[model samples]
Target: MNKMVKGRIYTLIGAIGWGLSGACGQYLMNDSAVSPIYLTALRMIIAGVFLTILAFFKQPEQFKTLISTPKEMFQILYFGIFGLMLCQLTYLIAIHDSNAGTATVLQYTCPILIVIYVSLKEKTAPTVMEFAAIFFALVGTFVIATHGNPFNLSLTPAGLFWGIISAFTYALYTLLPGKLIYRWGSLIVTGLGLLSGGILFYIGSASWQYTIQWKPYTFIAFIGIIGIGTIFAYTLYLEGVSLIGPVQGSLLASAEPISSVFFSIILLGEVFQGIDIVGIVLILIAVYLITMKEQLQEKHMRIKH
Candidate 1:
C-alpha cells in the first residue's frame, strides 16, 4: 500500500476512535456513578503515563530534550492543562448535558475560531470563502441550538455553553502546539502535556476523593476511552498528519463527528431532529470550506517555492 493510503486509513481510524470515545463517555455517564471531572482526571493520568512511557522508548532523545528545557516544560504543562485537559473535560461535560452527537458536532466550530484568530493576527482579510464559512458556521450553530426556532432556544444552556467553550479550547489546542510538536514531536509533547494536565487537574479538582463505580461494561468503556481512544487515537492521528500533512489529516478528521452521530443513533437510540441534521450539514460545509482555504494556501506556497 502507498504511504499516503496508509496515512488516510490511520487518520480515518483515529478520528473514528475519537468519535467512539464520546459515545463511551455518554454510556458511562448513563450507566455508571462517575462524574465527568473524575473521568477526565483518571483518563489524563492513565493515558499520560502510557504515552510518556511510549515516548521514552520511541522518542527518548526528543523527550529528554523537551523535559530538560524550562521554557518548553512550562509551555507543555500549560498546553496540557489549558489545551488538552480543558478540551476533553468540556466536551465530556457537553456530552453529559446533551448527547455525544451534539457535543461532537458543536466542537467543529474550532475551525471558524482558528480562521478568525489567524486573520486577526495576520492583519489580513479572510477570503470570500472564509466569510461564507463563518456565516455557515454561525448559522449552523444557531440552528442546532434553537432547532431552527427563532422564538425559543431548544438545547440546554449548559450544553451550549460548554460546547462553545470546547471549540475555543480546541482552537487553542490546534494553535499552541506547532512549535513544540515540530521540535520535540507530538509523542513527547502530548505525553508530557497529558501528564501535566493529569497532575494539575488531579490536585485541583480532588478527583481522588470521589469513588468510581467499577462495573464490567463500565470498565470496558473506560479502557476504550483511555486505550483505544486517547492513546491510540492521538498517536495514529499525529502519525498520519506527519505523513499526509495537517490539511488532509484535518479533512479526514471530520469522520469523528460523523461516527459520533452514528454511534449515538445506533447505540443510544437517540433521534436527530431534521433541523439538527441540516445544521450539522452546514457546519460540515463550513469546515470543508475552511479546509479548502488551507489547501489553496499550501498549493500557492508550493508553487511559489
Candidate 2:
C-alpha cells in the first residue's frame, strides 16, 4: 500500500478509537458510577504515562530536549492545566450532562473559535469564509440548544454550558502549544503536557478521594480510554498528519465526531432528532469551510512570498 493511504487508514482508525473512548466514558458514567472529574484525572495520568513511554522510544532526542528545557516550563504547565485538563474535564462533563453525540459535535466548534480568536489577535475582521463558518457554528449550536426554537430548550443548561466551554478550551489546546510542538515535536510536548495536567488534577482535585468499581468492564473501558483512545490515537494521528500534512489531516480529523455519533447511536443507544442531525451537519460544514479557508490562506502566503 502507498504510504499516504496507510497514513489515512491509521488516522481514520485512530479517530474511530477516540469515538469509542467517548462511548466507553459514557458507559462507565452510566453503568459504573464513575465521577467525571476523577475519570478525567485518571485518563490524563495513565494516557500521559503511555504517550511519554511511546515518545521516549520513538523520539528519544525530543523527549530529552523537552525535559531539559527549563524556560518553556511555564508554557507547558499552562497548556496542561488550562488547555488539556480543562478541555478534557468539560468534555466529559458535557457527555455526562448530555450524551456523547451532542458533546462531540459541540466540541467540534473549536475551529470557529480559533478563527475568531485569530481575527481578534490580528485586529482584523473575519473574511467571508470565516464569517460563514461562524454563522454555521452559531446556527448549529442554537439548533442543538433550542431545537430550532428560540423559546424551546432541548439540551440541559449544564450540557450546553460545558460543551461550549470545551470548545473554547479545545481551541486553546490547539493554539497554546504551537511553538512548543514545533520546537520539541508534538509527541514529547503533548506527553509532557498531559503529565503536567495529570499531576495538577490528581493533587488539586484529590482524584484519589473518589471510588469506583473495578470490574472487568471497568478495566475494558479504562483501557479503551487510556490505551486506544488517547495514546494510540495521538501516536497514529500524529504519524498520519506528518505524512499527509495538516491540510488533509485536519479534514480527516473530522472523523472523530462522526465516529463518536456512530458509536453513540449504535453502542450506547443514543438517539438524535432530525434537527440534531441538521445541527451536526451544519457544524461539519463549518469545519470544512474553515479548513478550505486555511488552505487558501496558506497558498496565498506561499505565492506572495
Candidate 3:
C-alpha cells in the first residue's frame, strides 16, 4: 500500500479505537457504581501495568535505558502526572459538569492550540489560512456549545472552566510527548509515561469511592478497550505524527469527533439534528485547514531554501 493509504488505515484504526473507548468510558460512568475519578484512575493503572509489562518482557534493554536518564525520568513524570492524569481527570470532571459531546469538542481544541504552540516555538506568525481555520473552529465550537444560539449560551460557569482547563492541559500533554519521543524511542517514552501516569491514577482512584463487581463482560471490555484500545490508539496516533507529521496527524486525530459522533449514534443511540451535522462538517473543514497550515509553511520554506 502507498503511504497515503497506510496513513489512512492506521489513522482510521486509531480513531475507531479511541472513539469507541470514549463511549466505553461513558458507559461505565453510567452503568457502574464507579466514580468518574475512580474509573479514570483504574483505567490508567490497568493499562499502564499492561504497557509496563510489555516493555519489560519485549524490550528490556530499551526500557532500562529509558529509565537510566534523569531527563527521561522527568519526561515520564511530566506525561504521567501532568499529561495523562490531569487531562483524564479534568476531562471526566468537565463531562460531569456538562455534556460528553461538549467536553469532547472542548478537549479537541488542543490541536488548534498545538498549531499556535508550534508556530510560536518556531518564532513565526501563522499564515492567513491558519487563521481562517481557527476562525471556523471557533465558530463551529460556539454553534455546537450554544446550540446555534451563541448570544444566549447556557453552559455552566464551572463546566466551561473545567472544560477549558481540560483543553489546555491536554494540549500541553500532546506537545510534551513529542519532545520526549525525540529523546527516547516512541515505545519507551509511551510505556514509561503511561506507567508514571498509571501510578498517579492509582493514587487518585484510591481516594475515590471504589467498588469492584466481577462482571465478565465489563472486565473484558475494560481490559480490551482500556488496555488495547487506549494504549494502541495513542501509540499509533503518535507514530502517525512521527511518520507523516503532526500537521497531518492532528488532522487525522481531529477525526476523533467524527468517530465519537458515530459511536454516540450507534452505541448511545443519541439523536443527531441537522445543526449537529452542519457543526460536524464545519469542524472537519476547520481542522483540515488549520493542520495543513504547517505543510504550507514547510513548502514555502523549501521554496525559499
Scored by TM-score, the top model is 1
Clashes of 1: 0
Full-model lDDT, candidate 3: 0.71
Pull out the clashing pairs in model 1.
none
How close is every model to the real structure, measured as TM-score?
Answer: 0.97, 0.96, 0.85
Ranking by lDDT: 1, 2, 3
For model 3, residues 122-199, the per-residue Cα lDDT tens digits are: 999877887877777777767666768867665677777887789889987777787777766666666677778877
lDDT on C-alpha atoms for all candidate structures: 0.90, 0.88, 0.71
Candidates 1 and 2 compared: the better one by TM-score is 1
Q: Write the per-residue lDDT of candidate 1 for residues 1-305, one digit (tens) a residue.
A: 89999999999999999998898888887778779999898888888998899899997887788788999899999899889998889999999999999999999989999989999999999899999999999999999999877778788999999899889989888888889888888888888899998999999999978876777789888877888888899889988888899899999999999899998998778899889999999999999999988999999999999
Pairs with backbone N, CA or C atoms under 3 Å apart (clashes), candidate 3: 80-197
Q: What is the lDDT, from 0 to 100, of the residue 135 in candidate 2?
A: 99
Q: Which model is ahead, 1 or 2, in terms of lDDT?
A: 1
Q: Cα miss at 264, model 1 (Å)? A: 1.0
lDDT of 2 at 289: 98
